[model samples]
Target: MTTHLRPTDLRYLRLVRASAWYDLVVTAGFATPWTYALLHDALSALGRAWGLGTLPPLDPIQTLYANLMGSVVVVWAVLRLARPLPLHGLLDGTARALFTGWQAYALTQGAPRFLWLFLAVEATFAVLQLAPWYSPFRRPAVRE
Candidate 1:
């Protein structure tokens, strides 16, 4: 039996490909240093603000976690690029959930100013991942 390609499927593939490229760039180029710096400052500030003493000097554990997370993102992106069709919905859904959670956390933290940068990045990623380009790749219920 032959399977026919639907417009939605095509769109989904496009989304997956785009998202894969984005992830690769962000993980390797943007997020690595950016997260390290942000985490360092945020943790230091939180420690100082609460008088909990200064954060311990950055250590191997911190580096390991950052590297692991970054590697995971890179691997996932590579997989999406290799198998765009099957991974499209999953990637988009994951991005949406992650961003939504981040938004909620930012709101609850009551540090809107600091969180805005993260919120903006997450929002942009969410929009790009869930755009009509990927709608075709979604399951029937989610497709428009």
Candidate 2:
């Protein structure tokens, strides 16, 4: 079946793909590394404060979590690039939910300094993802 997308839809798709790439680069360059370091430092500090002789090395589990999350984000980005309008809504919703979760976790953790950076990234992604759905930029569906 042939498919078509309106200009608005096409714009949104490009924005979504760009946003996802932005996320991947930013996370790999800053977010993930800084977070890993911060968590490692925090855990080590906690151990020191508790008078433990030696702190364990950074938790592999935590590193795995970050890697998995990053992988998922990359996958999402690739999907957006490959299948733009067809799955736009789903990706947008997913990004929103993930951002909301990050926000909640950040707040619960008393707003760690790094979280603000993460929030900024997440917010950008959310805005780009949701732009097409907004009243001013909504796109009409295609017909066969």
Candidate 3:
């Protein structure tokens, strides 16, 4: 498979893996209660440090949802990191775009200013992953 791949394909694969690594690093803490506790503490401390007040502690259900999101994203990231292809980039881009939309909506509903950071990162990855398709000089991606 490597022998048949072009240079552009290699670059695309690298991009996909990079995105996956980002996901893993950003979301891995959400996957378990202990990690989420640490993450929540750190975030709250950061919020206080930034002069933004902390919110109420997360309830069990909310924690469950966070855990679910973290677990799923981490697993998906691992899969892409281990076996990235152009298709993975396209799909991950689509997912990130959706995430960006939802995250924006959450902000509009007054979730938190902290979410802006995540939203920005998601939007960046979404564009990077999807932009090749819209480039005028884009080559057709090799089929998986």
Top candidate when judged by lDDT against the true structure: 3
TM-scores for every candidate against the unseen true structure: 0.53, 0.59, 0.86
By TM-score, how accurate is candidate 3?
Answer: 0.86
Residue-level lDDT tens digits of model 3 in 12-75:
7898999999999999999998899888888888877886656559789878998999999999
Q: Give per-residue CA lDDT, model 2, range 4-118, as digits (tens).
A: 3333555556766676667566554323656666755765575557654323465677677766676676666666667766366446656666877878786676543444555
Which candidate order results from sorting by lDDT in descending order? Answer: 3, 1, 2
Off by over 4 Å in 1: 1-7, 29-57, 103-115, 127-144
Residue-by-residue lDDT tens digits, candidate 1, 34-139: 6665666675687568654444566767666667767777887788788776446556656766866866785676533444545676666566555443545433
What is the clash tally of candidate 3? 0
Q: List the residue pairs that clash in candidate 2.
A: none
What value does the lDDT take at residue 93 in candidate 2?
Answer: 51
The positional error of residue 95 in candidate 2, measured at the CA in angstroms, is 2.3
Candidate 1 residue-pair clash tally: 1
Worst 10 residues of 1 by lDDT: 1-10
| Each candidate's clash count | 1, 0, 0
Q: lDDT of candidate 1 vs native?
A: 0.62
